[model samples]
Target: MSATHARKKPFLRLATAAVAMVAALGMAACSGGASTSSSSSSSAQVGDRSPEQIKEAGEIVIGIFSDKAPFGYIDADGKPAGYDVVYGDRIAADLGVTAKYVPVDAAARTEVLASNKVDITLANFTVTPERAEKVDFANPYFKVSLGVVSPTSAEITDVSQLAGKTLIVTKGTTAEAYFEANHPEVKLQKYDQYSDAYQALEDGRGDAFSTDNTEVIAWAIQHPGFSVGIKSLGETSYIAAAVKKGNTALLDWLNNQLVELGQENFFHKDYEQTLAPVYGDAATPDDLVVEGGVDTTSTN
Candidate 1:
């Protein structure tokens, strides 16, 4: 009756919130770069803020999820809780500045960065060839692939089974884009929030839902009736911090921070505090973590 086999979950884990709401990101054509590798750009094409400029600002605005949980979301105490939010704080602390958390959806991650609305996006921003042209990504810090969640009753076993089926997905997410490009036959019902997408799946609005496999696995565990049947829809991807295109100073600083933090295994500790609660022992840091802006999955 379940979709994903719990014993063999894929890498990349899950969720988010809202602050200073802005316009939603419209689906646009993207140019590709390497996805989730240790690669990054040495320069930016716009929004090049000097280190002094960032320092003088006394705060670094970080765009993060305000709805998806474990990875990012508003906690019971009405504050940000999740993996990305944790790093946002650390990034500010490293700069001796206040961490300003700006809530963003999957789609807004790029627009905010390119528009200088936020200094960076730590909201599960995956690297892709199309996305690379829009922003400069630092080294990837997490690794994940795609997954599909469907009700047990649907019996959806794989992505290929989704042909002609309407799958609900969060707006501006890679899922929507991926399906649009590669699986044009699969109809997508895009929602602005993850809850809406999950709701759509439950309400019979769509045959299934898809996103980062890591997240759907956590969701399948949390909500009993649903299961992540499709473990991986595409290639493994890296999750990296993204800054405005041409902001090499900020990009370098973020990359250096990742390398320094990796020495302390800070991301591991972060997983223990954030993701472990949701995934329990199902996911280890090495299963999905990328350290020093590099893919350690092969070695670890």
Candidate 2:
């Protein structure tokens, strides 16, 4: 399909899915008593006291991305700055503990949590069935969907258009699985980092790059000639913090914090302050940006 037609088709489908997902999430919130993470420990003590205990230990180590911008990145001054870092700070502050950031990559997040390398993970972890079965996720904080990007010279525009073309993606990401299951004919080039995959795309190593639309759009804006051809793909979910399994006390605390922060439009403010610069006026969904607490549940 041509770029023009590909753009039109997916947007229509995404619009439909967005509406349904929103309605379902809204209902889940109203019902309450959603399934809590099974990791909650029977012996885990709760209440504000938990945070107090952490603070007495002096610092809380958080896992975050060192290169993923607007979410987590080491700024020019050699300090972490981004939406996730900001949120991580807030969490530490609420816990009355000093926050220490541990830079992590895509493949190491789960291992870091499992090995207790970090007290919490603030990386851009998308909540999925497979991941949930391993690590426990807090309530949804930020929502994002996959996007297709290519140089302005390329004519590709949709998932189907890449049926026989090479597509680059970061290794161990949902994009790889999405294409493998839905568009198996598309040739894939996997890399370990976003920078590598994006550079490969710029160097003509692949016809296109696929990732969370938020990240792709940000990258395209930073580069002059590249553009995000397809903005939204399917029903990608929100980014949440993950803790080791059997840490229910920490999980509950994080979920409650998310809801409290949402009520005050913390995430909307976060986007405007951090992401809006790269995205401009037309970047995010108004509902998503302004969405007050989302339901923390296991259902759709």
Which model scores highest in lDDT?
1
TM-score of each: 0.83, 0.79
lDDT value, candidate 1, whole model: 0.74
Candidate 1, residues 133-222, lDDT tens digits: the string is 999999988999899989988758877898988988888878888898899989888888776787678788999999998888887877
Per-model lDDT:
0.74, 0.71
For model 2, the stretches where C-alpha displacement exceeds 4 angstroms are 1-50, 285-287, 290-292, 295-300
Q: What's the CA error at residue 68 for candidate 2, in Å? A: 1.2
Clash pairs, candidate 2, are: 40-248
Candidate with best TM-score = 1
- lDDT (10s digit) by residue, model 2, range 250-294: 888888887788778788788888877656755764534524347
Candidate 1 has its poorest 10 consecutive residues by lDDT at 25-34
